[model samples]
Target chain A: MNYLHLLDYAGVAVFAATGALAASRLRLDIVGFIFFAAITGVGGGTLRDLLLGKLPVFWIKQPLFIGICVIIAVLVFFTAHLVESRYRLLLWLDAIGMAAYCVMGAMIGLEYGISPYAAIVTGISTATFGGIFRDVISGEKSVLLSDEIYISAALLGATSFVFLFSMGVPQIVAVFVGVLLAFGLRAAALLFGWTTPRYKPRQGRKIK
Target chain B: MNYLHLLDYAGVAVFAATGALAASRLRLDIVGFIFFAAITGVGGGTLRDLLLGKLPVFWIKQPLFIGICVIIAVLVFFTAHLVESRYRLLLWLDAIGMAAYCVMGAMIGLEYGISPYAAIVTGISTATFGGIFRDVISGEKSVLLSDEIYISAALLGATSFVFLFSMGVPQIVAVFVGVLLAFGLRAAALLFGWTTPRYKPRQGRKIK
Candidate 1:
């Protein structure tokens, strides 16, 4: 439990940093950086809790989480120019955060007695929805719309956790495996420039 | 209660049509049209429900609501070419949908014993968030970023409803007034090209 809590906090800080980096890229003000950071830090968990009918929301219940995000945002705001290749940094940090979040989300779903299929979906959503929200708000194309294997990696991770759990694997072991799978896939995709195929329209077929 | 239900259904249909119109403008396929319509129709209410910790979201429970949205999307898909000035039609329909949704969201918030201030925020969010989601997904800039009075109108309408409710006004009458205020404000804005002032940075002022 303690380890999970640490992972959760670390995931949030990393996500917040990614959002702050995005805000810096757009040259937004400090307020914009904080707002984006806070949203990206908790957006996925908030959505998962909402879908699960959890009350008060996690961040609302624990102001410490938001405080952490704000602090990270402020730090990123002041130090953005000190970093080179901000985009690469954002991608790696986001990948690690998504990996941790996917496991946490899947566990929460199972704890709530949601069906396994639904739980996997919840996990994937938790891992990816925050980035989607951030991208949309910042006028960047959503990860979902890209050919990158981001969501697929989350889905694979989530499914592995659920499958391993159902097969009598220890909860911690299952989570470890899931996180490794997600992080490994994402890292490989980033390093190797792997991508999913884009949908191509058929010739002479009117889309409308 | 029945009247409220009717208004909800009508609002969903109207919102769905607007989404379908957006898809048509983007030259998306049938699946895209349906996807956009469904999201726009239920996005605001779903967010409200999730935030309020309401289970089994409205559309999931009813299914009829989603069915109606799908039907509307199909209709818009087929009839898009027959309509002149689809953009104008979409704007008008979206305004009407926002008005109805604002009142419905306020009523739901009051039923849940939320504070009046929060309830008003809920109303405005419920009226406008769907459009924001739609715009984001369609790769269009959200109306919130525009100098338009859209969100302000929702805020005004929601505040009116909550205030009137607190003053012991009848629910139906308060709702009527709220909807009228929102609709009228939006209509006037559309007609007269009313706009709020945009924020301009001072010369030589660093944003950081």
Candidate 2:
């Protein structure tokens, strides 16, 4: 298999692990883990395809994508407790998945003739929306709701790809540049607790 | 507009109102309120159409469907507190929207040549998934997670339509039968606290 295909599958596996880990924390049933894993792994791309009018979505024809998620989820369900620091694992794994997905999503958008700006937006949605759906559906505070650098990292990656490609960079080079930059920023955020600057608070604002 | 069109619009408006009300409870910003409204209004049909491979989705082509949701959400943002019993209003409005969406989803599914059983599944997904996403994203317990009769109501409506249509009932008559039964059941559940039967206690089960 090509490197891109390998990256794609690895991304799916890592994200699925995160999802299954979340399900384990919630003490959900096996079915819940698989459901969460499947959605988290595929949700972002599904949204991208649907919005872009790509018929049948990416996973419908080759359900091996979904099968990978299901298997990972089941594995995590059984072995999650063995992980020393699930939260840290979740962050590191999510960083890997997010970068790969961001580039992949942008690639698809560009292929579909979407404009650069909208393609970046598509990339961001692809990388982050799945985790948002996963956390939200699980009654966890959504990642987007946090005043963190997570989504900003995705934005950076997508923008970098668009800019590089527009500047005549080879598609492969642009993709790697984007993915590495995004993953690096996210990793830094996790390691150093970097966060977005919060808005100056107005009095009487009840931030729930 | 035809009767079906009226139902469709009204259903969207009501669902949007529910979404806005949920956002109000969460004290979300106006943008958040409107975003919630649009998703809650169109989320189900979006899922249905995407799965059925109906390209561009129902809203991408019309745009008016999204416009209606935005208008309702904004109106509700300023007026939600005026309602004395927002929860009661939410339940009633949800009942109306759910019934209409269920029938509409089924109609589209059957039109696409999906089997009746899968069509019913489609209807349930279309009617309930939007609300599921709304509540989950808003950090509220999802309706589907509750041991309630909500999905059952949608199931009944879709099934009734499929049965009536297959039995040579007029299409319009079948539609009405489905919508009415769904609404009736949901309304009854709200009024009477009619819940799904729970399994007999397996003690020490942490059904969180």
lDDT of each: 0.83, 0.82
| A83-175 per-residue lDDT for model 1 (tens digits) | 889988999999998999888888888888776766776787688778877887898866544445676688779989999998999998999
Q: Which runs of model 1 end up more than 4 angstroms from their true locations?
A: A29-31, A202-208, B1-45, B51-53, B56-132, B141-208
> Candidate 2 — which residues are off by over 4 angstroms?
A1-43, A51-128, A134-139, A146-208, B145-148, B202-208
Model 2 pairs in collision: none
- TM-score of the B chain in each candidate versus the native B chain: 0.94, 0.94
Q: Provide TM-scores for the models.
A: 0.61, 0.63
The model with the greatest lDDT is: 1
Error of 1 at A194 (Å): 1.9
